[model samples]
Target: MTRFLHDQFAKDYLEELLTPYGTIQSSRPVSSEVREVDLWFSPHPESTLSPDSLGLLARAIQTPAIFEPFRNPATTREIRDCLLKLLEIDAELRRESNRQVSLAPDTSPPHLWILTPTASRTLLGGFGATLDLESWPRGVYFLPPQLRTIIVAIHQLPRTPETLWLRVLGRGRVQTQAIEELEALSPDNPWRANALILLNRLKAHLERNLNPDWEDRQLIMRLSPLFDQQLEAAQLSGLQQGLQQGLQQGLQQGLQQGLQQGLQQGETLVIENLLRFRFGEVDEELAQIIQAILRLPASEFTPLLMQLSREELIERFREE
Candidate 1:
């Protein structure tokens, strides 16, 4: 169960960072075997965000790519499965460019990225992976250019701000240390906001049990102060804005509007996080439904959004 949650968090973390820079297709299916890639990213010519923001992590991805992140060390078999998915994509891209091949050469197919907490020397040797220590940071092993794959050993990565984001995907002490660094980041940082939101959701999930694991309990304790800080800051900002607007719009009406707006924003956050937890990522139609639900009081929308399955939520929200 912990592994499952970690896998989901890795996907969500990658999506949050990469989606603004290009296209992100999560759980993408390939071949006739029905195998799914965790994340398929294709960079855009006109990206809004620079790849450099991702630090050493971004250096590994400069082309169409497939991301397969594991909660623990990935086995040789799992690595092969990731490669097979890339080959299937290669075949499909070739099929599409059959006519174009006569006029111009085709661009290379997507590369596969195996993200794991650790990769043993034997494991790296088995696949003939090489480390480019000078250009790239430590812990990154690349296969021959033809194979177009890289293995990221998260535990081996440097302990710095540049690598902190990737280290959060690691295990045990590494992850705990990364979380501490994450909180130290400026609250206005977008990654900081996204990470905290996911951590809160993770905390909620673990708390459902009467007694969560010791690690989870410790993590929740670490996250609580950050959560309180954000809440307090948001409330203060809302009050200041409300005071200014109240003078012009009449005190009672302006305060009411400000309070409602604040609550609705909270509702939207909860709804989106719950949807992502259950459905991976929300799509356009679902986003619309979430907006509509936000119009309702929190009591009415909260239970419906949290309790329903994807289909059920869509059906119920769409009908209303």
Candidate 2:
């Protein structure tokens, strides 16, 4: 996959998975120069979802963090660049701490996670990155503590539940296997549907590429069956709920009005589900505009939900 496409996918995927437990700032700008952190996350003091659901990724984000994911192996220059960002953030945090006497004594800089599919021995050696197997898993290499950086070599990670989330960003066989595990997860698993939906979105983006490479073609093929399965399941579930709801309404109101209302309610549920998946929460503003968006045909509204920003969606649907 191309870097641009993969970068967007990584950001969105992590954001979707982590949003409930913390604050997420994708493409967060830093300093006067135009530098952007791919993803910055700070965990909520208390969250509904268990950290165990995300496994190792949860551990990585226990504190404030900066995540920079690479579709391919990271180069030495890229590694250094990530460290520079880390140092910059450290300085910024220290400055703020100095400015505010009330700041906690334990306040510290965010950890930097450089996520790459693979890191060659030579590359790791140059950075003096060493494994801390006692404290972390195999695949996680830490640069000296002063640097406060960790390079997660996705391919090197053990194939287990703990590694599944990060492995979803791996390439070739690794990613394919992760997808299989993700597909096998329980339907009730909170992250399962969201992960699948983001993967489906990634598949759609790959399809739009005019001349896809071999790996991109392979990824698209892998996602096809899963996409069809999710679509069918979602449709069936919606239809069933709508039918039951319509029947209940018919008993109370006129049969025609009840059935129509039931269908509308089902469609509304589907739209709300999509919104929640995309934006993490359906706040008052978003809840108010659901009916407005529902007025459009599926072809139009589906893309609107998938592609538009929150502001764009509100601007287009709120007035009507």
Best by lDDT: 2
Would you list the C-alpha lDDT of every candidate in the order shown?
0.74, 0.84
Error of 2 at 266 (Å): 5.4
- Tens digits of per-residue lDDT, candidate 1, 161-272, equal 7788789888778988998898888766767776766666565556565756777678777767765665455444544554444444544566677566555454566666
Model 1 stretches with alpha carbons more than 4 Å out? 48-52, 99-108, 209-212, 247-320
lDDT of 2 by residue, 167-205 (tens): 999999999999999999998888898888788878878
lDDT of 2 at 151: 95
List the RMSD of every prediction in angstroms.
Answer: 5.6, 3.3
Clashes of each: 0, 0
Highest TM-score among the candidates is held by which one? 2
Global fold similarity of model 1 (TM-score):
0.75
